[model samples]
Target: MNNLFDLHLQIGSRRARQHIQDTPLWQLKQFTRKKKVPDLSSLEKFERSRKRFERKDRLLAIASLSRFAKLDIGREKRKGLPEVILAEGKLATDVAKITQAMLKRTGRAVVSRLTGSQVKAVRSIIGKEAKIEYFSRSRMMVVKSHSYTPRQSGGRVGILTAGTSDIPVAEEAEVIAREMGCETRSFFDVGVAGIHRLFEPVRDLLKWEADVILVVAGREGALPTVVAGIVDVPVIGVPTSRSYGFGERGLSALAAMLQSCSLGMAVVNIDGGVGAGAVAALVANRVGEYRTRVA
Candidate 1:
C-alpha cells in the first residue's frame, strides 16, 4: 500500500526506492493504522501522509520570547531558508531580544532595515559571543554564532544598480547572497539613461558566468528589462524608493517593472532587498545542487 501511494506521487521509481529505504517499517505501520482501514485508495493515504509530515515539520522547532514573538527555528530545515528579523519599526531593544533568541536556537540571524542604535544594541546583547557584520549603506546586519562558517556552493549571482543611489539596496542583496554562500558580482551606476554605461559590466558578468542576476533601479526601473534581454540567466528587478514628485517614491518604477516586456524578468517590492536576495540565493542554491549532481 505504501509503495502504491508512492507511485501515486509520480516521483519516479528511484524516489519510491528511497522512500522504502529511508522510512522505518514501524513508522509506516503507524501511518497506515491511522486511517483505520485495511484497504484504502492511494490518494486518501497519500493525503493523510502528506498532512502528517507537514504538521510535524511545522511544529519541529519553536522558541518563545516573552509571549510577544515565537521564532520559527525550523524554518531553514523546512523552507531551505532561515527566518530573518525585520527591524524597520521595532524598538532597538526588541530587535536585540529577538536576535538573541533566534541566535540561541539557529546560531544565526539576519536583521534588515536596522538603525544605527539597533546595531549597537544587538552588538551589546551578543558581545564577544558572536560575530556581527553591519552594512551602513544597506542598513542590514548579520549575526552569526562563533561556530558559523560560510557553506560555499556552486552558483553565482550578479547584482546591478541603475544609479549610485540604488547601491544601498544592491549592497543589501550582496550581503545576503554572500551569507547564503552564493558567489556574488556587482555592477553599479548602469541605468538606461546612459545605455552605453551598461555594456561593459554586462560583458563582465557574462565572463564571470553568473547563474542569476538582480537589477536595482529607482526612477524608471527599466534596467532589469534591459538586463533580461541581454542575459540568458534569470533577472530579478528591485524597485527602490528613490524618486520624488510626479511618480513619488518608486511607484512608477514598480509599475514599470511589473509591466516589463522582457521574458525572464521578475520584480520585487519597493526597497525589498532582502526578498530579492533570498529568492536569488534559493535559485542559485538549486542550480548549484544540479551542477554538483551533473558534475
Candidate 2:
C-alpha cells in the first residue's frame, strides 16, 4: 500500500524553505544570513523574494492519503473535530483500511453511515487496537483507544427527537456531541403533536444548564421551533426523512425549519445529524467558556 505520510515531511520541509525565500524586504537580510547566500543585486533580490513568496502562497501540501482516501489529520486542531469517515458508499475493504489508518494516527476514529459488513470489516482490520462502540440505530461506530481521556468538564448538549423514527438521527448527534467533549442528554418521541411530552425534558435540560439543544423531527418539523422558543440557548434543528406525502422525504420539514419564527433556531440539512451535532458542540463550547469566565 502506498503511504500517505510518506510525502508529509518532504512537502512540509520544501514549503518551509520556500517560505524563507519569500521573506519580505525588511527580513531579507536575516534570510540571507540564515541561508548563507552570497551578495546579489537589489533588483535580483527583490525579484527572487517576490517569486519565492508567490510560490510559497501557491504551494499546497500533498494530500495525506493511503490509496483510496485522504485523511485530514489536523482537522481536530483546526476545527475542533477530527475527520470522521462516512462509509455509506465506499467499499467495505476501503473503509477498513482508511479507518485503520486513522485509528493508528489519532488513537480514535468515528465512522458514520456504516453498513453491517463495513462495521465488521473495520473491527476485523482494527482488531484489538481500539475499543469499538456501535450504534445500530444510527449506523455509526466509534473506535476509542484505551489510553484516551478527555477533559472532565466541557459544554452540555440536549438531544431531542420528535418521534421514535427520528431516534437514529438523534443518536448520531448524541454520539458526536459526546465525542466532541460535551456532556449530552437525550429525549426521544417528543414531537409537537403531543406538546406536553416536551415539558419535562426541556425542564430537565434547563436545570442541568445545557448550553445548546439539538431537536430532530420530521413532518411539520415544529419541534425545533417549540424548543427554541422555550430555551435561551442555541437550538439546532435536524429534519429527518420520516414523513411521506405533503412533507415527503423531509423536504417540507426542512422548509418549515428554515422558516421557523424562533430567533435562536438553526437548521441543518435533512438527516444531517453530524452537522447539527457539530454546530451544537461549537455553541456549547462557547457557553462553557462564558460560564468559566463568569465563575
Candidate 3:
C-alpha cells in the first residue's frame, strides 16, 4: 500500500485487480490473527499475506558512537530536505567517529555541534576532506554543506536581529533556510533603543516582498512585537540566550516574547534559529504552492 498510487500503472491488469479484492480478506485475517481468532489460529494465514505489504522506502542507518546518530538517507526524496547532525553532550572524538561513519555511507556529509576546542579534535580526524564551519554564537561547528544545492523559491523570508549580539542565532537561521531552498534575505542590529535605525531596513524588506519574517532578539525582546505591527506577513519571534544576570541571557527574552501583546505572532526557543528557519521555509513553500495552484 505504500506505493499503491505509483503501482497502478506498473502491475499486470488481472493481477492488480485481484490485489484490490484480496486486500480486504488479508486485512480481516490480520485483525483476528492476534486475538481469540474464534477457534483455530488465523495467524499462519495472515503471515503469508503480510509479506505483500512490505514498505518500499529506504531504511535509515543508525550510527553508534558515544551517543546515537540516526541518518535519514531518504530525506532528499521524501521531504526535499537535507540531513543535519545535532552536536551536543558528546565529546570531540565521539562526534568525529560519527561524522566519518556518515560520510562513508552517504558520502553526503554530516553536521555536528562542537566548541572551539572540539574543532581541533575533529580537524585531526577529517582534516581537509571535509568543509567545516564554526558558528560562534551557537557554540557549534558544522561539518557538512554538500547535501543540497538550494534553488530559488518564492515568498522570501527575512532574518532580522535585535543587534550584533544576536548574530549567532541569526546565523543558525540562515544556515537552515539556505538548505531548505528558500530565497532568503537578512538584516541585523536594529533594535528598539534606536527605533529610527529600524525603519530604513524595515521599509526595504517590504520592498523585497517577504512572505514571513523571523525576528531574532535577546534581552527585553520587544523587537518582534514592534516588527509585527509594521509587517503584513507572519512574524516569528526568536528569543535568544544572549544575556547575563537575568536567567542566563535567554530567560528574560523568552518570558518577554511569550507575554508579547501582539496578535498573529509566533516564537521559537532560545537560539532555536534552525527550527524557526525550517518553519518559515515550510510556510513559504505552502504560499508558493497555493499561488501555483491558483494560477
Candidate 4:
C-alpha cells in the first residue's frame, strides 16, 4: 500500500510539471517576477504632474472666504452664466472681499441687490482696481478689469414692464441679460390697464428680431399673458412686489403669472429678475449660437 501511494504521488507531480510547461511563458513570468518599483526620478516626475493638475484645479475651484461664502469662480466656464453676487443680506466688507476675489479671478464681477452701504463699500474697495458700473434703480453693479472685454453672443433680448413701478425689477433683468452679452431693448409703462401701449413695443421687438422677451408685471400680472400671446419668441414673466391688500408683496402677481392662460409663457418667482434674465440670456445665446453655426 505504501509503494502504491508513492507511485500516485509521483504521477501527480509529473502532471503538475506538464501543465506548467504548457502554460504561456508570459503568464509564468507574471507569477515568477517581481514588479519593478518606480525610480526616484520617475516618482518625482509623477508628483510634479499631479501638483500641476492640482494647481489648475485650484484656479477653477470655488473660492472660499473663511466661513461666510464659497464663491463659484468657474460658473461661467461650467454653466455659461457668470456668477452674480447678491449683496442684499451680506455684510458690506464681505461683499467687497468677494467682489475683489471674483474680479481677480474672472476679470469681471456682477453684484445684484446692493444696498447703498454695500455699494459704497464695494466702490471703496475696488474702485481704483477696476471699472464699476452701478445702476441705482436696479441696485446692480458690474465690475470689469482693465483687460476684460464683454463677449457678444449676437443675441437680442426684449424687456417690457407692465407699469412704472415694475421698472426696477425689469431693469434688474436687463442688467443681467446685458452682462451675459445679449443686446437688450427695453420698454416700460405698458400694462394691461392700458392694453394699447403694448402693441407698438411688441411690434418693435418683433421687427428687431428678439430672441426672447421678459415681461415684468405686478398686481394682477396680466401683461405677460398678453405679451406671450402676441410674440413668437419665448416669453418670461417676472412678477414684482407692487400690489396691496390680500395679495400684497407680489403674491397676487405671482399667482396670476403662474396661472397664466397664455401658451408659450413661463413664470419665475416674485421679483426673481436675476433668474429671469439668466434664463432668457441662455435661450438667446443658444439661438444666437445656432444662427451663427447655420450662417
Candidate 5:
C-alpha cells in the first residue's frame, strides 16, 4: 500500500495524514538487551499492549479537562470565544480559586468588571505572580492572550466616533473586536459639531475599504445616519453617554440613532460596546470569507 502522506498521486484514506505507526523494533531490541529478554514473533500481543497504553493516555487527558474545579474546559473547543469570568459579585478568594483552576485547565482566563478592591483581593490570593491587567476606562480586568495564539478571523472594520467623549465606548469596541481576531482602524474625535472634520475623515475611512463601520456617537446621534448615507458597507451605531442637560445621559442619543433615516444601519443598546463589536465581527468575518471565495 502507498504511504498516506505521499504527494505523488498516491491513493489512500480520506485523511491525508492518517496516524500510521512503524514496528517498534528498536524499543524491543533495547528491552531485550537491558532485561536479558528474548525477542518474540508474537506481534499481535505487542500491538495490543501499545494501543492500550495510548488509549489510557488519551482518556487521562480528557478526564483532566472534563471537571477541573468546576470549569468547563471543553468550552474552549466548542465556542470560538474563551469562557469569561465576571468579577462583579463573586468574592476575591472564590474568584482566585476559579481563575487558577481555569488557568490550569485552559491556560487562559478573563474576568470582567474588576474593581480596585477586587484587583487587590485577587492579587493577594494569586500570590503576586499572576499577570492581569486593568482596563481603567472599561472597568474590566483581563488575562490577555490565551495559550494558543488566536488567528485574525475578520478583515478590517473601520471604527468612528462622534466626539472625544465617545472614546471610551470606541475603545471598548476596539478591544472586543481585536479580541475576536478582527483587524480594526479608528477615526476618533470627529463630531458633527465640525461637519467639515467629520466629512473629511469619514471620506478617508471609506477610502480604506472597510468591511463594516462601527460608528459610536453621543448627543444628537446624527453621525451614524450621515455615515451610513455615505458608505456602502453595513454601519453599526453605538450611542454613548457623556452628554449634558437634556441628553439625559445618552437616552436622547439612543433614541436619535434608533430613528435614523439611513438604510443598512443597525443600532445596539446604549453604551453596549460589546454588543456592537460582536455584530461588527460577524459582518467582517462574512465579508472576508466572501471575498476569499470570489478571489
Candidate 6:
C-alpha cells in the first residue's frame, strides 16, 4: 500500500510539471508576479476616454437655444469670422433668444436684416445684459457686452458705393468689416456715370494704405471693374437690386460683375453684403497678422 501511494504521488507531480512546461512563459511568470491592480488599468482607460471626449467636444462646439437654433459658438475660433444671425425669416422671439445665447457665449452678437419688431424684441429680451446698436440704413443690429472692446487688427478696408441707392449695402459691409476689427473708409455716389468721381476716393484709399476695397454697385455694375483696373489691391464687387426696366432686380448687375474683365476683382451674389465684408475682412486680417508677425 505504501509503495502504491508513493508511485501515485510521483505521477501527480510529473503531470503538474508537464502542465507548467506547456503554458506560455508570460502566463507562467504572471502567476509569480504580483497581480495587476484593476484600478490602474481602469484609470488609464478613463483618461483615454476623457481625452477623446474633449477632442469631440471641441470639434462640435455649438450651443443649442432650445430646438429653434444651434448657434456656432466655435466659429470665431475656427474661422476668423463670427457667426452672424440672419433675422429675415425667423420669428422675432426666436431672433431675440438666439441673440441672447450668442451674447452669452461670445459677448457679441450681430443680427442682419432685422425688422422693426425683431429689433424691439431683441432690445427688450436682452435688457441690461448688453448694449445694442441698430443701423437703420442697413437694418442690422450689433450687440456687445458692456465690458467688451473690439481689438483693432490694424487692417484698413475701403468701401465705395456706385450711387445713393447702394449706400445701404455698403453700410452693411462697413458694419461687418468694422466689427471684424478693420478700420473702414467709405465714399458714396462714385459710380461710372460720373467717372471722374471715382479717382479722388481711389487715391484717398491708396494713401490710407487700404488692404482691400469693396465696391457696392447696381445697374450696370461697371464700378468694380473700373476700380480693380486702377487699384493694385483686391476689389470685391457687391451688386444691389437698385435697377429698373430691362434686367431689373440686379440680374444685369450680377452678370456684369461676373463678366468683368478686371484681373483682381471678385464678385459676390446680388446684395451679398455680409459675404463681401467677411471676405474683405479675412484678407485684411491676414495682412494685419503678417504685419504683426514681422514687426
TM-scores of the candidates in the order shown: 0.81, 0.78, 0.71, 0.80, 0.68, 0.81
Error of 4 at 55 (Å): 15
Residue 73: error of model 4 in Å? Answer: 0.5
Candidate 3 structure quality by residue, lDDT tens digits, 1-295: 5443233335446665455435665554544455435632333443344444322334343444444566666665456555666667777776677767666665645354466656677778878776776666665555653553445556478888999989878877777776666778888899999888899888888898777889999988889999998889899999988888857769988988888888878999988887888888878877866766787
Candidate 1 residue-pair clash tally: 0
Candidate 3 residue pairs in clash (backbone atoms < 3 Å) = 87-113, 243-249
lDDT score, candidate 3: 0.71
lDDT of 5 at 68: 28
As for lDDT, the candidate ahead, 2 or 4, is 4
Kindly report which residue stretches of model 1 are placed more than 4 angstroms away from their true locations once superposed: 1-55, 58-60
> Could you tell me which residue pairs clash in candidate 5?
none
Q: Ten consecutive residues with minimal summed lDDT in candidate 3?
A: 53-62
After superposition on all C-alphas, the RMSD of every candidate to the true structure, in Å, is 8.1, 7.9, 9.5, 14.4, 10.0, 14.0
**lDDT of candidate model 1 versus the reference:** 0.85
Candidate 2 lDDT by residue in tens digits, 21-70: 44555465555556555573553554576676655543432246666787
How far is 181's C-alpha from truth in model 3 (Å)?
1.3
* Candidates, ranked, TM-score: 6, 1, 4, 2, 3, 5
Best by lDDT: 6
For model 1, residues 1-295, the per-residue Cα lDDT tens digits are: 5454444356346677456445555555566577464654554555567667766867677888997788989887777777888898899999999999898787899888998899989999899888888889998888999997767877689999999999999998888888778999998998999999999999999898788899999998889999999889999999999999888799989999999999998899999988899899999988988888999
Comparing 3 and 6 by lDDT, which wins? 6
Candidate 1 local Cα displacement, residue 267, angstroms = 0.8
lDDT of 4 by residue, 1-295 (tens): 2232233235347654345434444443343333332233433443455567656775677988789888898788778889999998899999999999999989999999999899999999996899999998889999999989898997899999999999889988999898898999999999988888889999999999999999999888889999998788999999999989988999989998888888999999999999999999999999989888999
Worst 10 residues of 6 by lDDT: 1-10
Positional deviation of residue 205's Cα in model 3 after best superposition, in angstroms: 1.6
Q: Give the TM-score of candidate 2.
A: 0.78
Residues 1-295 of candidate 5: C-alpha lDDT, one tens digit per residue = 2332241123244342122234354554454456554544443454565577666654344323334235555553544455566777876766777766666666566666666777777667655445666677766555533444655775668899998888878877776676667889998888888878887767777787788899999888889998899889999999998687886789999999888899999999888876687678767877777777888
Show pairs that collide, candidate 2. none
